[model samples]
Target: MDDIKAMSFETAMKELEAVVGKLEKGDVPLEESIGLYERGAALRAHCDDKLRAAEEKVAKIALGPDGQPSGLTPVDGL
Candidate 1:
């Protein structure tokens, strides 16, 4: 099995999309479909985690005009 940890977010997401496309095509045998589904689940989880980490990084606030760094604040009505 490939180590998802060593893969970049783009790679993982691309692989997941490919797997989903294959499954949607309905040409794979049942056994192959099951295997692909399992792999897709792992890749999806990895992609989700990477996205969350990215969102956290994006949400980080730099020092404001006061020159003191501030934590992230939620957007209104989120």
Candidate 2:
């Protein structure tokens, strides 16, 4: 859990992908598979939390005037 708390979204996502691949391969022992599934779920939850935080920040943004500075585009395919 501590490790997950410290992981960036991208890192967690990569680990989650690996976990999914292992589970899909169907070669892991049942007990190990269960553990992997739990880890994957945790990673997923962490990623979701990070995304929600990002969404909240994005929502608070306001576009500047045409002559003013322009930044912060829509998060496409989020």
Q: Return the TM-score for each candidate structure.
A: 0.76, 0.82
Candidate 2: residue 19 Cα off by (Å):
0.2
lDDT of 1 by residue, 36-66 (tens): 9999999998989899878776666566788
Backbone clashes in model 2, listed as residue pairs: none
Candidate 1 residue-wise lDDT at 16: 94
Q: For residues 34-72, what per-residue lDDT tens digits would candidate 2 score against the true structure?
A: 999999999999999999988876765667876454665
Off by over 4 Å in 2: 67-78
Per-residue error at 48 for model 2, in Å?
0.3
Per-candidate clashes come to 0, 0
Compare the candidates by lDDT and give the number of the best one.
2
How many angstroms is residue 29 displaced in model 1 relative to the true structure, after the best TM-score fit? 0.5
